[model samples]
Target: MPCRGAAACSALAPTLPSARTVAAGGQPMQLPADPIEAARTWARHDPDPETRAELEALIARGAREELAERMAGTLRFGTAGLRGVVGAGSNRMNRAVVIRASCGLADWLIERGLAQRGPLVIGRDARLSSEALCRDAIAVFAAKGLEVRHVPEPCPTPAVAFAARACGAVAAVVVTASHNPPEYNGYKVYGPDHVQIVPPVDAEIAARIAAAPFADEVPRVDDPLAHPRVRPLEGLRERYLAALDGCLAPRPERPGLRVVYTAMHGVGAAYALAALERAGLGAIEPVREQIEPDGRFPTVRFPNPEEPEALALAHALAERTGADLVIANDPDADRLAVSVPGRTGGFEPLTGNQIGALLGDHLLEHASCDRPFVVRSIVSSPLLDRVAAAHGARSVATLTGFKWIWHAALELEGRGEGTFVFGYEEAIGFSVWSQVRDKDGISAAAVLAQLAERERRAGGSLRARLERLYRAHGVWVSVQHSVWRPGLEGRREIEQAMAQLAERRPETLGGAAVERVIDYREGAQARPSYLGRAELVELQLGESGRALVRPSGTEPKLKIYVDLCAPADGEIARIEREQRERARAVALELARFVGLEG
Candidate 1:
């Protein structure tokens, strides 16, 4: 629900201000020594009238705890960049925070002489506040006399990434929360390499942001839409589409297959549908209700395609059309979700790891480029490594997120160690080719469509192809479970839980004895190739499987991932069933030991 300003946020305030007052992540809403004064200071400079009124209402009602929570700490740059619920205060995603972040980025760029390197590119999605935030960022950039190239309309996140590299921009900023809920919005920054900002750079930009003036004090020009530096992304889509076409195999053999595609009420339909058609695939049937871009995302609880519920409408359409496959993209169209028909007359959604493995195998099988290699997140299924090895390609595992994946790909490509043929994280994000160094649902969707069609022409389904790959590379199954802990206290609890688990290493997990416990934080030093510092724990359970536990980089939850595999000794069907059952049992046990039950 949209928080109704201060009143709605303050309804739960208690008699006396206490340090234990819960707010975001269940963290104690420690009241500032002078909460009322702090609220007044923040409200005075708040640029958004709605958020200003929100703070004023809380101040008027002596909602000190609520006010404190809102003003406790400014939103800092993280793995996902600046993101939070849209509302008042430094901690939220209101105009004030956006302006400050822009100013900080501007200052960092100018200080580093990056403004002289190239123009900055900006793009936005169809989120409610996206346009407004884009304009706000433009105002700051223009005031600083920096050249800017802006996408005139809502575009996929990858478009901005591609434009940043293709346009030779020093940095690019996309005003989107990606797959976050409707109430949230975010700003993601990409460097000249077109990868997300990492450690030292993020810290430097954050320092500049901390030094930026308050929202109201920030200077701005009259209409950023009329600014001279602002120019539309002319010919960008054509270039991106051409690059996408390069991801598919030559002499494409697309069968007459029925496909159901949905954008999940996002800005992807135009790009995705066009890509599918360009791939010479069969007729496309879109989920009518979800074909258009609607920021409200009224049809689903969350806009993320990774969530099974988000694809309910697409599944229904698939069933009605007897579609051979279902493909979906999140709101920004940067991630993909694939579902195939099941025995019970319903569509079965594939896990991110499953999709990754399938795509990795398919891409490797049709290798055309030299030095072909694959990349996957460290927590993703290890089956991709075996697939790459079987195909005589190298596989590298990096920290979670496409930022690291893309960065590592570039590093490899630069040194001629390998060329990034394909990359994916176990979160429905994939980069079919290195043309765009980010997870691209539009291109990934196109490649998947072509692959599915080819499989269909061979009188086989994706399921059959998957089974074949499993046979070639032993049956491997994986599952992900998350422990939700919202608010600040929840974050602390998650940290404590991780510490407890790490300190008290279990001698056995599930029914198997633990062979070794790897703490990534400690092992990072030993492994120089590891990207960044991460709080992760991995348990190697002999031959049964492996389990990895870590706190979510973006959300207030503890994520646990488990993988189970067996040698392909029996019939494919029996092996698949046994492996799935074994995976489920192992996942359940890991969850009990490290997730919800723990």
Candidate 2:
């Protein structure tokens, strides 16, 4: 039967055909029996005219294969929430998908009896489709009889996170893709604890989303913001700034720190600048071309600050302005990147581990807590543990992801193990303050600025401070190697590689002996309960170094992290260079051992 309209299609459940079909060369294939029918149903119910037309065009062109791919499966909701290219299908990030996701989230909240606890906060970035999708989410929440609060403009993600915590909301959702490419958009859900939803909860939400009603069938309020259940999330930015004020300890202002900052065409300019000024950090030179919240990201090939090309303009500005420090925030402004003027003149970007070590040392040095503790992800450099121990503080390592990092910190603090001072991941994500459980690049930038200024006031530079710390704790050099394998075959290859490594552990890597192997999948009684199970393998090389192999949670790639250390008995630069080479060699060996040498 042909679907006539939106109401008619709501009753249709487009399920994958169970029967297999023959393909070219008599190969077996499992594809939808009638993808056109599925497309027609989806098109009828798609609220957005753009997406509806998109599906219609595909159907008109008899693009059966393409349609099947688009309808292969719904987007998977993991710990990171939903992220994908914006388009017109169940597998894409679109209005219909957002509506269904919102409805499911509403169902989960109601089932958990959290819907009436507080308002559900919604926020979005400057992505092209973010505003519309955010509205769709708001409408669904309002229609579900839940109180909705939303940020009025494009703002840093940390601002939304802080708003969720300060407002005592039951849950929050941010419509953003963070540092993902321009074509991507995402939905990030935060539990009442002000952190990303973790396991059991993530699984629960996924089940609800899978059982959600069709987009058109879900009740939605037109002009949701005007509804009595919805209200503007006011004073969010101001409150965020006020929280930043608490991140800094009282210290003399160093009015001479010249810094060049870039938002990478993100929404961080206003918030970062306000935080800097509030801290009495001298005027920061903003990259004019990339300061605004332009989703197109017209200035860079990639919006991620960790990418060298993304920070090229900032480096240029820093050189031209003779700035002492260069700081950048990824789009959505949840992660931070920094560079400092090298002894050789040009600005040298600091690795995430370097920054983490420096910031960990700085925070511990001035910590007010009698038992300050820091946390780092398993993939992050282990130097933080040394830094923590040097300061007589405890250091905890959790499974990869800021969600795990923050949750571990909270659990430890609750048990009176220590006061949570800071936590960071190897991906440039940092949480300088505990109030906002997730990473806050805006606050981190301010704290980094303070660290830079303090170093300058002491007649030293960040580089010099880093060297001093290295001298105290052996020099640690960390490097990351990634092997990209896209599509189903690639995913299988990644899984095979991990399985092989776990089965046949390498005796040595880069000529260094592998003393022990820790497979995270096999939970350890010695490990904290919150560490959880993850598909990660760690090869400990005694005092020389260590290597970690794991598949990326978000992208289709296998990642290997190598960390090597050397005594700072000689030239620090030479030791760092040599250790870095050793680390890269170890990473390459690990990749080759897993048959992922590409």
Candidate 3:
């Protein structure tokens, strides 16, 4: 089953024990060994009534399968930290899990002699159970005899990371689920460097968590916020806002453009509006319906800006206002989504790649420092590479996620390789400045607003600028396809698929010859620190096209990323259409090769 470990299996529910039941391919369903006993033990010690009752109900109903699933081992901590549904059981993210994670982190720091270094910073987002989780963590850290600082209020993820670095804290914890569904929440940890924890640190903390005392056994203090070691995060918001302001340029004149922005019911609107206005891009109209921080995210099915449906409200608002541009940020505001008015009236949201290219080009063009460089995920559009090169800058590719991108950027700066200017991932994450060594949607939105204003003043549009970029560079188009692979069996299927692909690497994809294959599983390439031991495969194709396959780190899905370049000289529209078709074709082939159904 691509065995992560016995503990993970214990936290994960296995197949049904029914005599007639079989696996996906008519194979015998192998049940987890004594998972019910483990589940009972976990339930007995669970501190949360909701989750405890959940386990009790499953036990009362004699739901062996459900109980086993709940008892299956604890969720493993990785680069993204702890993320799961909020419910009972060790596999879930609950008060007990949060307590253990926090205590374990405390133990790790203390063991490293970092407990006396500085206060640890903690922040929460507007999500159900987020505050509770944050409180649980604070109590644990306080009880561990370490100082702690809490954000003055619920803020974006980047703010917490920024606070960790700005405050010189030994570490930080952010209670959020990022763009996950409302039913899900997560715990993200950052090291002293303010970047997400990676490698031995994550492993050490995970081991400590696994070995921690039961929830009730862990000492808890009441009103940890009032404790002397607990300090208020005064002026953190202002500091973050000021950092974002640094990304701005003196606008010759306010473009007086109509812009509609939506926070997707996130904690970003307040910060986003302030940053945009401070950048002198003129005031922007807010999508009032989705303005506030509503953890329920009632307006959209998904809180991610990359989803077209998530931006539906913003698009409608933009059209009604005849807005010149549209901007939307995901729940935590670590990612941004921008849209320009389409020819047909509705606003057309720009793909993360397009936005990355535009932002990279603009920032590189205006860069005043020498040895300027931009960073992008290996799977992201290579168009940024061309853009950076054209502007006499270098483009560095890192493994996916801001943890890797930011670390790479800092390493380059430390080594005097170049000055870190911009960094982005295809999944709507961007880091416009180094102030917050992570994705800062607030600043990214501000930068884009400036771009739109400049383009408008030049008698052009962002889309026109994009077309010019295309005409200058080749038409770099890309598409992503996903196959839902849930549970342990699903994980096994993904592993088998990747192994099969490695065994028989495709000779061609979408009529393009496969030139080479890069298997990240083997660590064949120099990767970011946080991407240690991740299973991924990439195929380098002719014409600057690439096909990458990997299981989503945070979601139960197999993702296939495809990128292709086509001639952009003739009809830009025609080239775009043709290249998009080619990208889709390549994605389809990769999906098929990975045994995913269309």
Candidate 4:
């Protein structure tokens, strides 16, 4: 038996105390001390009846032993709080899970002496069960005597991030799974500063949440928990649009630019097109099938702008309209991907790296008079550094999460330094506005619409412009590879392999010389430095930038990020040829060892 905290060991089942008897390693299994009550709590009050039934079934079948592994404790809280599949187990996301998390947040705020302040701001995406989960948060926060202001409409995750600053609330919670599937939803917490909680703060908040008690009954306050003080925010939409629109070459006269937009059945379609229209780029066409917000994601299985199939409909529309450009937003519209036709008449879905390079170039040449700096995720392409150099700006690389990028922006702004020209994560999220405070595709789309128009007027296509960019800067090729790391066994297997690789530090990958291997787990890198280690192993590919291999912090997958740099024009063809051959050779090794299917 392990020494466990009281919260971790709380009774998960009022009906069946015997349900937890199970074995790990053929010994009487004991739940972990870290999140002791995780399993039992779910068994008792998780809102999903199906999940609850599933847990009850699992427990009744004398399978409680497995429960120890799943719920030996609470889910570990990272920069992003409590993201997982919706289910009735300790490992899954459920109502009880949310309640516990909210309590933890409330306690943290009270400690900060922010509990008595005006309502906390809560926003949600159009994911299944998201609205209810957000409402549950409002209920709990209101019961705690903390007022609440809910963004009544579905919004991108960044909007909630911005609202944290806009409302000046103590905390902001966004109920979104980000780019995850329909079956998944998550809880994201933003500090009073509108940045995701980092360092001692996240841990401190989790500890408090783990220590706090759940309210048995919803408290009836002067303001109904169901309805926290709601306020109508008008200009936030306009301000974000204006800020994003400024990123383009304000060529308003060319009404000939035709642009196709798609939200991909997420919450961002309306605002994205609106921004484009406001930018005075008239020809705005929406992919009608994906226009409406549907949490089930009927049109596409994966709601990612970078996904090829996700934009198939959008591409078809582009072909139909001969549109100058096609832009697609993910479920929350935080990330944006553009599809421009190639020489072969097949529209090419530009990699996140390609878009970043173009957008960086566009902004560098014509950014706000404030003269902003560019921020990119460490895992993204380094080509932005070249563009920044040309524009006489700087590029800062942070951890993979957008939260890090957001904080980096705030950091620069706080110093009274250059304004944030642009910020992006490899996974398609971009923030063009220093004021909106988070990634806004609406802004990106507005700028992209105008950029497309300007390119048209100059007698060149956006694709042609990209080619010119490649010619000038350098040919940069970046690829993200994901391998399955599903369930307990698979996860363990992947880790064991990682451990072996770490111990034997490979000299090369796919014939490329490995200059350095950054192993995160060793004691050589500690605390503040190790904060970025969410299971990461980076391979520095000589002068061709590097490749980062890490498990997805948000999903059950291992990600391989590859980047190659060469002289601009001919380099694209050279890099493409080399990339295909080298990628094939090296990807095989990666796939074989890492167990990647795609």
Candidate 5:
């Protein structure tokens, strides 16, 4: 059942020059998957020769393993759809997986009985595999007697979700890895309502995809460069922009905010700028180096806005231009982060938690809703709890993905259960409205711009608003400790950590004692409500809140989310000191416990 020898491996190996083998028991274990052949199989009928060659070379010399590793799994279709490295494996998001997933989605549409009245819309990002994945999806959907409307050019993923509802399609698919390395790509599914598919729907779709027969079993066409869908959705951008216009409330103050925008080599610039103007914030500038869509992602190592390094150019440009704010969107533009000047004349990147807290406060105070329910994920800060309580509104915590928030929102809207107001994840994702089921950076950018304008006119800055939230809610300071594991051994090493931590739970970290421990692995709450749950330990130090650990569903990283709520009179210095100490303690303990090399 296991690979025995390199000599035996070479027999069916795609004649690559070298093999990447690792030692097992004693023999060099060959990769169970062939990436070169996977790439070849993907590219044999590819329309673009350059793209095909690029994939071929990348896959040839053990590309199969890389692809298999990336595609070998299902790209993880949880509350959030697939987000991972793009390669030849089923685990990764290769064209084959996209085809399989799309076919399965088609079956779902047929079964749902929405196939005749509605079609499927396809959208994508600037990732290398995005275009191919989109094409693969289109072909599959078209063959299933469903109309497909493809976005003509690279665009933000939310637009596809938005267009699904606008075009009367039953569902939508966006091919984007979204904030992962350039080597990664992914697929996120949306229902006709333009929100993510939740619970039984996701399970049903995955099942249909798995049950799908061979690729050839479906319709096969030798044609390339042909439109598989009924036609490209040419006016998708305009429709989204127009709809965004209606979402904004009246401007609070000056029409110009002098903002610096960056798309992070993804497809968010045009729409984001439109949003700024729509919010009556004019003269917004974009960081040229990162605005345009570039698959190579030449500027940053990873296209995540959460990373300070990725926002370096934007921050620099903001300072030089003396802009009011700097906004950076992740590759797919589903998430947005901002940087504002601190006391020392330099910009500080606001953590996703900080931004979400600010937005939560603003929406709760200003939104014209009928008792809206605020939603956030487990990994996000509980600061929303404070804000929601102040408004007499109910708040719900779902698993750490927008899918959970989307489902909660849909449930409320469906039964007129409750008004869905604002939802956000700590990782730069926010759903300000239910217009789009998935997070929309463009829409949120507009909303944020409006909020900033209103606040500036009200005698405060976004920074001030955050500080106010800090003062009112006792500044819930949070930090993340992530342990990155590279290969299979690395993966095993990381997974082994759960057992280790469970066995040896820390009583104290940097002098902060654990008040309570929530073992989500035991399904501790006993409530039948929570979905996609995991082990969550509530480490309440002498301070506010502390989270022990959880495994990243999308990545091979062991995550420790730490939070400390400081007092109102607490100086920024005190908060920073504790954050540093707590972060150090967690990292020290994790590193010492995990026993990985420095």
Candidate 6:
């Protein structure tokens, strides 16, 4: 059948020989009946030569097991959108999958009468496959008769979110796997509110994608960039920089605060540096080795800043230059990591909870609203509640994920509750200003730098400031442990583990009595409207601490978070050390109960 639409129809046609025509060992290749037919269909529809040949090779060799794994089913488009290894088949992230997803999104927008509200903003990261996937998305949307605003270059995820709001976009899409491996890529969708799509919206769009036409049959503009409905999204960088101005509170310029930064070989260096310069601390040193964007991430084992080894280069640079602080951003610049000079010798990295607490306190102290509020994920440290109480600001807790955190903030502010000052999760994700409705590493880094400078002027270090906060509130410490299990069987094992833990709850952990247990899944009716039901369990341990266990939303792992605190009447250092050890013990116990190792 001749494919319709676009002069580049040949691109969608199979460019390789049929798998049935090739033989292995000079004999007819024998393959499974059902899987081979599906593979052949996938090969015919895949527009990229790499994925097409990949499927063809599998079919030629009669690789039934691998083929079955690849063609098991379509990739699930959940709230986070599509994410998987870059390869052939419907289960992976390829041109065929991206085309279908884009078509479905276009249809969903048109159906909701949102297509005419504003142009759809699209952006990408520096991954090897990001550009091609972004191109396919733009072409699909344009052919569907939606105006598209293309961000032209690799940028931070927060930049895309800001652009979505800046241009008043009906929706936005970004082709970047935030902090995932190089072999992986993703498609993230944002609604008109400039937040990630949640709940019924995600389900609705997924249904549309399921009903979308095959890759080759979907209409696409051969030259989407040149098409009348598509135009270059200009001034995004400048506008994003201007938007970051709110993060820098009016403070005297205290120069000479030596700060070291790293991008982890991602797309955050340029935007971070620009934001810092605009904040007046322009003499920041960049880790030359990992400053630029490289999809392969040659310098680190993983691109995530949460991984200690990922910040090894930045630490080395900070030590050599006698820097005061070190900051880093993940691949897509949606999360921030900070390290300070340790009391012993080398630099010590702060947990995401600690950073969140610090930023919350700082912003609340400087907040101007009569009624200010801060938000945190339920899994975050309870110390934020203490800080908010001290400052007389409301502290709200929601389910994990920035989508919920931002949504909670907006809901409260809209209800005359309070002005949203700051919000963060325990995964190094933060939102410092209201302009960018998502976790913004660029602005967070700027605000952290300002905080460090303010402390320096007062003859105090970040460590000293943290200690002061601990003394004022209580000494709070948090630790996270993850148990990773891969593949389908691993997923089942994880589910079974959760179920077992839920059935037999722990009475005491780390010698702290579990006063109350809150099963988020079971208490949907009693929970507030903003907090939805999820597979999460929380064990509140009175004043001693608390522990939360849930499966990671973005990765194949079970994550456990433990928070412990003590009065600062004794030595703060000794208290923190003891609490950290106790928290680790609690985490290990939880892991054992769940049939996994800590």
lDDT (C-alpha, whole model) for all candidates: 0.79, 0.83, 0.80, 0.69, 0.71, 0.83
lDDT of 4 by residue, 299-336 (tens): 88888877888888888889988887788888888778
Tens digit per residue, CA lDDT, model 3, 409-504: 766766667677888999988887766777889889988888898888889999999999998888888899888887667878888888887788
Assess candidate 2 and give its lDDT: 0.83
Model 1 agreement with the true structure over 1-598: per-residue lDDT tens digits: 0101111111111111122211111121232457688778878877889989999998889997777667768887766788888888777888878887888788777776677667999999999999999999999888777789999989999899889877778889999988999999999998755678776678878877777777766667678868897777787788888866666555355448788999999999989998888877666899989888888999998888888889998898888887899999999999999999885569898888889988888887777666688889899889999889988999999888888887677666656675567889989999886557689999899888888888888889898888887888888878787888877777777888787887677777667888998888775666635455688888998776798889887777888888887888887667767767766666667666554553
Ten residues in a row with the worst lDDT in model 4?
1-10
Task: Indicate the residue-level lDDT of 291 in model 4.
Answer: 94
TM-score of each model, paired residue for residue? 0.91, 0.92, 0.92, 0.86, 0.85, 0.92
Task: Give residue 278's error in model 3 in angstroms.
Answer: 0.7
* C-alpha lDDT of candidate 4 relative to the true structure: 0.69
RMSD to true structure for each model, in Å: 9.8, 9.7, 9.4, 9.4, 11.1, 9.5
> Model 5, 113: alpha-carbon shift in Å?
3.1
- Candidate closer to the true structure by TM-score (higher is better), 1 or 3: 3
Q: Give per-residue lDDT, candidate 4, residue 402.
A: 71
| lDDT for predicted candidate 5 compared with the true structure | 0.71
The list of candidate 4 runs beyond 4 A from truth reads 1-41, 47-50, 63-72, 214-251, 368-371, 520-534, 568-574, 591-598
Q: What ordering of candidates by lDDT runs from best to worst?
A: 2, 6, 3, 1, 5, 4
Off by over 4 Å in 6: 1-36
Candidate 6, clashing residue pairs? none
lDDT of 1: 0.79
Give residue 117's error in model 4 in angstroms. Answer: 4.4
